[model samples]
Target: MDNLPISSKYRSRPLEPLGDAEREQLAERLNDEFARGGIDTDAYRAMLDQVFAANTLGEVASVVASLPAKDTFAVPVVIETGTAAPGELLPARTTGLRAPLLLVAGLGTGIAVAILLVVLIIL
Candidate 1:
């Protein structure tokens, strides 16, 4: 019927002629779905307006189908590091020295302290 909305006709059959009210109702349904997903009402309204203005039933259906149904989730990401080069895998090098240097320093310190004490006693 000419008086009925286009959306209802479209729903019933693709070839059916659509009326303005049905188009508006379908747009509203799309907007409502988007709003439920936390999209701002004003933005949803604008999108609905665009959907309503679509000339073809296919275009209107496309817009309605585009509405997000639920919260979107991203896939977890993983970072991979390549293997180290031959010698580079070894522990870091220290500037001061290791066991040999520590032994020398310790002996020198002990001698220096002993000499100082002897000199003090003599004085």
Candidate 2:
């Protein structure tokens, strides 16, 4: 069998200081990779700006680390369209349900938890 090249040897890029064209190429490649990874383009651009603002290689690495890690799992989105029979009242209401329900439930839960915690501390 023929000998195969080492993966590390193929993977390593030259470490010489980047020139203007090289920097632009690198940025383009990074943006492409970010987009392919399903990242928000605007957020990635903001992160790129932060990376450029970094003075040192270490600072750039820190900026990269500070950006949220790419999501590992792909969630398949299901768009559901409901059609009700003519003149039938749909019990599930979408309008104003989300914010109001969430706010009320959160506030109620928080109050209950606070009361419980206070009672526990007193007892």
Candidate 3:
């Protein structure tokens, strides 16, 4: 086999300083990755602190590069139509309608209790 010639030697350059917006964007990306379980809590916290402290874009990039690549998980899409038979039962929607109502009711009760307590304290 013939020996192949090396193309070009890589040259290292000084890292450019990161702007405020660029730093924020990188932080968001890292947070998203962490939310996806790409990195553990410890690693995420360390990396986040480093990202905030990083002055150069290269430093942030290095932290990002250390994390694993995002997985290509496919999300299933569901399409519902109101054409079901009258006698058929349908699955409950994931959206918690009752939960919000209950939450509001609980908050209202809590405020009323707090007001009553304050009135009793004053008297």
Please report the candidate that would top TM-score against the real structure: 3
lDDT tens string, model 2, 1-123?
012123221113223333455345435655876867845777678767755654443334433344344354777787545697766777885677789998999999999999999999999
Candidate 3: tens digits of C-alpha lDDT, residues 20-108: 98678667888888898888999888988988997775566557566554444776687566978977998887766988999999999
* Poorest 10 consecutive residues by lDDT, candidate 1: 1-10
Candidate 2 weakest lDDT stretch, 10 residues: 1-10
Number of the top-ranking candidate, with lDDT as the measure: 3
Give the range of the ten consecutive residues with the poorest summed lDDT in model 3: 1-10
Model 3: per-residue Cα lDDT at residue 35:
92
- For all candidates in order, the CA lDDT equals 0.63, 0.55, 0.70
Q: Show how many residue pairs clash in every candidate, following the order shown.
A: 2, 0, 0
RMSD of each: 20.2, 18.4, 17.6
Put the candidates in lDDT order, highest first: 3, 1, 2
Compared to the true structure, candidate 3 yields what TM-score? 0.43
Error of 3 at 102 (Å): 70
lDDT of 2: 0.55
- TM-score per candidate: 0.33, 0.29, 0.43
